[model samples]
Target chain A: MIRLEQVSVFFGPTIALDGLDTTIEPGITGLFGPNGSGKSTLLRVVAGLLAPNAGRVTFEGSPVATSDEGFVRRVGYAGHSAGLYSRLTVRENLELFAVLHGRVRPDLEPLLEQIGLAEHSATRAGVLSAGLKQRAAVARALVHSPDVLLLDEPYANLDDEAAALVSCAIQEWWTPQRIALVATHGAKKLKAFAHGGLILKRGRTVVQGSYRERPEAETFS
Target chain B: MSGVGFVAKTAALTRKDLRVEARSRDTLPPMLAFAFTVALVLAFTLPDATRASAKVVAGFLWITVLFAGLIGFARTFEVEREEGALDALLLVPLDRSGIFFSKAAANLVFLALVEVFLVPVFGLFFSLDLSSWLMLALVVVLVDIGFVAVGTLFASLASQTRSRELILPILALPVLVPAFIAGVELSADLFAGAGLDDIAARGWFGILLFFDAVFLVVGALGFEFAID
Candidate 1:
């Protein structure tokens, strides 16, 4: 389990996460929050990308997410804006990231096929459609096979069929040993696929636990 | 997160950057064009006597490089800063210091290529001899190492700001002063007919060497904080 204790993140004078405390358990969990509700910030903190101003983020009861150790081997992340090198083909981007993650010559064909980008792997990320790019971004995150998969708005641009395919892929990859957190504003199928959910309002947990009850959280859950 | 040693990590980073540059053509072309244009303008604009003076000619060459480099330097981290690619880079497991060194290495590669075209044209326009081109290249490369070492650091830092193009020069130029001074001095002596040995005897070369070493180390260590 990942425990967040009084974590707060300040951007200049504005607060992004305000003394928030929560636990991210092992299993696929839906993260639902309205715009500017700190969904992305929370994922970043968990991924070890952004360091919180105060409090601790612990994984398995050990403090992390605030060091230069590249404390991210176990965590996979795809942010709100998909981060891919536009000039590179989807294949090259996946291969490059795999090398950086220290997995030499990784076999990415299966992951690419699973994400539904097997044929489009040769297409430059800049030229790919928004939905295709989103697919590629998902594949990029999974290339390292991280145990903790944290995807922010992975279904934003995907169509119904594509969303369903991605959801199925996510479900197939997630196991009890893994922690899967997908933040979404839409896509009910993906939300329904999640076992539980968390909600944030201006960076504080307004409600969390089984979110299938609330209609709004129902879609992202 | 297997341990890829320093050299392997640096090579991987550089390879990624070089492929992007080779395809996108975002950085090198503008820098080379600006360097040549400035040299041509100077060739026509300067009085014959001033152009003939070794120190003045050396100053013009160094100044042109410094200004033209600004164009390339501003865009060195363009790939990383765009979208959320920097976060992806930070996610990968490696010694973070390798990021800084790789950036410096990539910038050095671009600037050195610019000089390949730049020095010949500079020598021709300013009526300088190409006989000691080897010595001149050595001096320019030393300056290039120091320049890119500091330039890559400042560029990465400035890229985080709202107005990065304006911020890069402000952050980099001050720290680069001593190296620029040493570069011009060493090159001027070479153009003034001093051999490499003679220039070494004066000890200004030490300043260039030390400046390169100090900033290269500082840039690597301080880079983690700069990005954070």
Candidate 2:
């Protein structure tokens, strides 16, 4: 379980996450918000990439800081920008992550196949198309089989087929032991997979419940 | 996921860097070309008498290496920044110091390769005997460590700025003055037939080592904050 208590984040004068409080259990939790709605900030904080100004974030009860190597090992984050080495081949990129995570014999072939990149595994990531690169990023994120996964706008630049691939991969990877937080703009797509979700407006949580109880269109507009 | 041991993580990171450089051929060739071009320009421009002096030649060679190395340093984190790879690396559970050491090692290798071409060309142009080549090689190795130690830290810091190309040299060169001076002085002593036993030569070597140690420790300690 992950908990954010009285969490507040600021960027200059802008409030990125405003006194936000929430708890997420083990499951797929879709983060629904429009632009600048703090979805990315929330994921970043949970991933230990950013620290909150006024509160604390805990993973299974321990505070998560960027410097906590032990805490970070169990968590995986893929941001809006696909964090990949452009000069490295898809296989090499995944292999590096696996090594870092201390996997002695990483099952790379399966991951490559799962992400629909087995054919392009040898290709340099710099030359891969946007959709394929996104898939590669997803594959890299899951290479270590982290207990906590945070993905921000994973399907932003993907084509329909690529998006489907990523969506299915996430579904296939999700389990009771792993907590996945997917921040996305696609409501209908997320509705199909997410058990529950939170809706944010202007850095505040406006709604929190099962996807079926999402606020009407007037509340969002 | 338990993280790998420190040595294993550092080796993996270094290998990744070398493999990327080996395939892309992006960093080393440009560094060598820049160094060689500067040497050629210096060869034609220097006065005939001044060009023959070992001190003058050593000074020019060190300058060429320093400026050429700036190119490598600038690109150190630029590659990571280009594709958001730095964030990926940071997300790993290994100590951030491992990232710093691995990058410094890789930069040292690139700089050393450039020196392989540089030393021979420098000797040929200056009409100097290669008798002191061993000592000179040691000087190059020590100096490269100092350079990369400080350079990698500043490179990571500069990568966060919008004007990274401008910010790297500005931030690195000022902090590197002591190392640069030590490198030039030590190289000059080596070229002038001073043995390692010579008091002045030993002093400069000590300075080089000291600078390397200090910058490496600082870089390792401060790297997490700089990137975070």
Candidate 3:
């Protein structure tokens, strides 16, 4: 389990995350919010990309900081930007990430096929289509088999087929021992697949429960 | 990530950068173009290349390299900034300082390649004596360490700001004065056909060695926080 306690992040006068407190259990949790709602900030804090200004985020039982090697190893993230080296081919990018994760040159052919990038493996990430780049990023995140997955808007540009491929990949990757926090505005498939949801407004949690109890994006505001 | 040792990580990152550069041909080509243009203009404009003062030749040669290095330094970090790829690297569990060192190492290699073309152009164009050109090469190698050390750090820091192209030179120049002075002073004597013993007597060698060491230490320690 990952627990956030009084976590606050301030960007000068703007409050990005306002003293958020929550506990995320072992399963996929949908993180929902409208524009400027701080969904990304909360995920960044949990993923140890940005340290909270005022509070502590603990994974399992230990505090998480950007410097914490264990927390970093445990988390895999696909940000809003498709974070692949533009000059590297999709295969090379995945291989590089594998090496960075301390694995030997991996046979990522299976993963490439899973993400529907097998045909585009030799293509440089810079010139890949938007949907393919997003898929490549998702594959890069999963290459290390991280115990905690923090995916931000994974379905933003993907078409129906690509979205289903990614959804299947994520669902298959999640096990009882792992926890995944997926931050998106609203997707029916993601809503159905997620075990629970946390909706935020201006960085503070506005609601937390099963989908039926949670308000839709339009009604929540 | 824990078991990935520092040496392996650094080597991997450096190799990846070089491989990408080799295929993309992005950073080096433009850098080479810029450096050679400086050499071309100097070669033609001077009344007589060989008759030019050692100070003028030396100053221009090093100045050409210094300005061209700015291009290479910025380009080296451009790979990391694309599509927020830098955040992905940071998310890895390795010590963040390794990122700084790898980047500096790669920038040093890029600058060295530029000089490979640049030094020869200066020597041929100016008709300088090559008997002691090796001594001049030593000065360049020594001073470039300090140049790249601070250049890589400041490049990363300035990358965060809005006006990075304008900000890089401004942030990096003040700290680089000592290396610039050392490179020019040592190279002038070498260009004038002075041997190592004679060049060493001038004491710019000491300044350069000390400056390189200090900048290297500062870069390694401050790099992680600089990006933060």
Candidate 4:
């Protein structure tokens, strides 16, 4: 489980995350918010990328710090930007991450196949369409088989086929033993998949419930 | 997931950099081209008398290497920045020191490759003896290590800022003054036929070593904060 206790983040004078508190259980949780509503900031904080000023983010019972090797290894984060080496081939990119994550003789063929990049495994990421690049990013994030996966706008620029590929990948990977939090503006797409979700306004959680019980479910259309 | 050992991580990162450079040719060719161009321009500017002086030749050669290295450092983190790959790098469980050292090692290799052509061309242009050429190689290796040790740290820091092009030199050049002075002084002594036994040459070499040790430590310890 992941828990944020009175978490607050500041970017200069701007309050990116207010004194927000929430608990995220295992399984996929759709993170919905308008632009500038702290969705990315919240995900970054959970991923141990950004440190909150006034609160604590804990995985299980331990605090999440970038310096903590054990904690970091359990987390996988894919930001809005693909976070891939444009110059690297898809296979090389996955292999690099796998090696870094300490997989001796890492088997990347399955991941490439699952992400629908096996055909373009040798192609450089820079030349791929935006949707393909996003798929590569997702594959890289899962190379380690992390326990906590945080994806920020994973389906943003993907085509219908590409989005379906992502949704399938997420469903296959996000088991009960793992926690996956996906942030997206399109709640309708997530309504069919997410078990629960949190809606952020400004820097605070305005609503928290199952998708069907959400007050803004009508607006999801 | 179990994390890779420090040595393994560092080697993997170094190999990744070399592979990327080999395919993309994003860093080395431009660096070599710029260094060669600088050598040509400087060669033309020198008069016959000045060209014959080993001191003048050594000074100009080090200057050319320094500027060429600056160009290389400017692009060190550029590819990562473009795709937000640095965030992924940070996500790796390896120690931040490993990241710093690997990057410095890669930069050192790139600088040394440029020197493979650069030193020979410099020797040919100046008509330097073979013995001086030997000492010049040693100087280049030491000087390049010192340059990349500090350059990698500043490049990583400057890359986080919006004006990375303007910020890298600003952050790096000031800290590199001592190394620059030592490189020029040592190169001049080597070209003047001073062996390692010469006190002047040995003293400048010591200064260069000190600079390398200091900056390497600083870069290893400070890299986490710089990227954070």
Candidate 5:
């Protein structure tokens, strides 16, 4: 589980997140919002990827990544960018990720197959279609089998089938031992895996409730 | 500290980068050709320097390396940015400095390889005798390290821009002039059989070593901010 206490993030004059306090539990937690509503900021804070101008983010009741090395191993964050090696093959890219995380050999074929990129394994990631590229991005993110998965706009270009694979990967990856937070606009389809939802607007959470609860209160407040 | 992990991470980055370079053979071949062409053109244009001095050879080598290294450094982060792998790199547990150093190390190795052919060609054309090949190698290594350290840092910043590739050299060239000057002058002195101690002064080589250390630390310290 992750916790944030009165966290605020500023990009120069622009305030991305304002004095926000929230707890993110295990399972897929949808950080739902409109454009520039600070959904991404909140997820970054919980993942320890961004430091708050004020306040703090903690994991397992301790400061996340108290050391730089500690954080690198503990959190897996996927930003809005695709973040793949365009010139390298999908398998090579995954192998590199695995090696970075201390795995001697990563069985990426399984993840590649899961993401429907098995045939494209030898192809340069840059040459793949957008949906396939997104799938490859997911494969890289999960290659290390991280504890907490933070995905920003993960389903942007995916077709229905690809989206399902991504959704299932996130769902299957979520348990008491691991957590995933997804920041997205087209998150209605994520209702099934999301144990709860945190609706952010104008840099603060307007509502925090279960997936079955109405997001209307959060959107309006 | 995960120093070993940091090394592993750095090696992974270097290997992946080199692999990508290998895949895109066209990307590097043009630069090699361009470097040799510059040397050949200079050789044909000049009267055979029956009296070619070490100073002349030193200047020739530095200019060639600068132009050639600039092209290579500019392209260092291009593949990653285009492929969308930069974000994936930032997501890992490695320190930002580790990323910077790995990139620097990779660039250093590459530029050194190019210099291998470049130096001898410069020597052959200029009719200069490199009395101490070992000393010449040291200066080359140090100078290139300094150049690539700062160059790698600047490349990352430029990689995010609208005119990514074209902008890297413009930004990097101005910042690297001091290091380049030191490298060229020091190597010239050494080639001319100047006092080892005198060459150590701006010994362009020594200056380059100093700059290498400084930039390595600066690049390491500033990497987190740059990548984010």
Candidate 6:
């Protein structure tokens, strides 16, 4: 479980994320907010990409800053950027990342197939369609077999087929032992996969509860 | 052992970068050819190819490597930035300097490889002897290390901006001038039969070594800021 205690992220005078506090546990959690509402910033904080000005972000009982590498190893992060090489083929891209993360498992080929990228494995990432590229981006994240998945606007640019593939992967990939936090404005379609949701308005958590209780509250303020 | 892990990670990253460059095809060959062609042109222009001339200045050769090295360094992080691999690399638990050292090592290797072809061609053009050139090679290594040490980090930062490759050399060259001058002067003095024991040559050598050390430390210290 990841805990954010009174966390605040500031960029000069503009407060990106105000004094925020939350406990993100195992299971799928959605961060819904309008543009510039700090959903990405909060997710970046959780992924250990950004440092909060005050307060602490901890995984389990240890401080996040103290065990960056140890904590980073546990997270599969897909930022708003596709975070992929357009020049290299899908297989080359995935292989490079797997090596970078030090995951030498022989099952990478199978995992690529599992992600439905088996056919496009040899296709250069730049040449692939938008949906295929996004799917490949997610695959790179999971290559390390991270226990925690932090995705920012993952569904962006993906078509229905690609979206379904990603959604299915997220569902199949999630477990009580693992956690997934996805930031998106479109949470309605994800209700089938996500168990709960968290809403942020102007850098503050406006709501945190199950989707069934308050489906209307999922929208940004 | 942790430092060793850092070194291994650095080597792996360097290899990965070289592999990427290799697949791209045009990156290294053009640099090798460019270096040799520059040497050939300099050779033909000299009064006599076998005898030292005004064009045979050691400063000029070091200057050549600096410019050529910048070409390779600029391209070093270009593809990675475009592809977003840098973010993925950052996400790894490796110390940030692991990224710097690995890149420096790889740049050193690529630059060294180009120089392997370049130095011989340079010697051929200038009518310089290989026996004396061996000492000059150490200066080349020092100059190249210092050049890429900071160049790689700047490349990473500048590759993201609107200027693209145009900005890296602009930022790198001014800082590189001192090291280049020191290296070139030191090598010229050594090649001119001034004993390595000469105080001026030794001072210049010390300056080049010191510059290399500074870049190495500064590169490691400032890499996180640059990458971030």
**Candidates ranked by DockQ, best first?**
4, 2, 3, 1, 5, 6
| lDDT for each residue of candidate 1 in B30-73, tens digit (9 for 90 to 100) | 99989999888888888783357888888888998897887898
Per-residue C-alpha lDDT of model 5 across residues B118-223, encoded as one tens digit per residue: 8888878786667878888888887887888888998888877878568888887887888878777777777777777776654355567678889989989986
Clashes per prediction?
Answer: 1, 0, 0, 0, 7, 1
Ten-residue stretch with the least lDDT total in model 2 chain A: A212-221
Please list the residue runs of candidate 5 whose C-alpha ends up more than 4 Å from where it truly belongs after superposition.
A10-15, A62-67, A212-221, B1-4, B25-27, B44-50, B130-132, B157-182, B189-211
In candidate 5, list every pair of residues with a backbone clash: A72-B93, A83-B84, A83-B85, A84-B84, A84-B85, B182-B204, B199-B203
User: After superposition on all CA atoms, how large is the RMSD of candidate 4?
Assistant: 2.3
* lDDT tens digits, residue span B122-161, model 6: 6666755456566677778877878888788787778668
Candidate 5 lDDT over A1-221, as tens digits, reads 78889989999999899899988877677788778999877776776666789998888888874235566676677777667777788888888878877777567777777778899999888788888888788777788788888888789899888899898878766667788888877666677667778888889988887655665533321
Which CAPRI quality tier does the interface of model 4 achieve? medium
TM-scores, each model vs. reference: 0.94, 0.94, 0.94, 0.94, 0.84, 0.85
Candidate DockQ scores, in order = 0.58, 0.68, 0.59, 0.70, 0.43, 0.35
lDDT of 1 by residue, A1-221 (tens): 88999999999988899999999888888888888888889988888788899988988877765343545777788987678999999999998888887877778889888889999989999899999999888888888888889899988888988987789778888988899888888646656678788888998998777554555555442
Give lDDT tens digits, candidate 3, residues A1-221: 99999999999999999999899988888888888889999888888889899999999989876667667777899998888999899999998888888887688988998889999999999999999999999999999999999999898888889999999999989998899898876457687678778888999999887555454532432
lDDT of 6 by residue, A1-221 (tens): 88899999999987878889898878888888788889999988887777799988888887764127787777788887778877778887787667656655335776677778999999988788877787888998888778989888778887777777788888878878898999976676576678778888889998887666777655533
lDDT of 4 at A19: 94
How much is the lDDT of residue A77 in candidate 5?
A: 73
Candidate 3: which pairs clash?
none
Q: Which pairs clash (backbone N, Cα, C closer than 3 Å) in model 4?
A: none
True lDDT of residue B61, candidate 5? 75
TM-score (chain A only) for the predictions, listed in order = 0.91, 0.94, 0.94, 0.94, 0.91, 0.91
Interface C-alpha root-mean-square deviation of candidate 3: 2.0
- lDDT by residue for model 3 (B8-109), tens: 888889999999899889889989999999999989999998899988998998889998999878776778778888778887877878888899889999
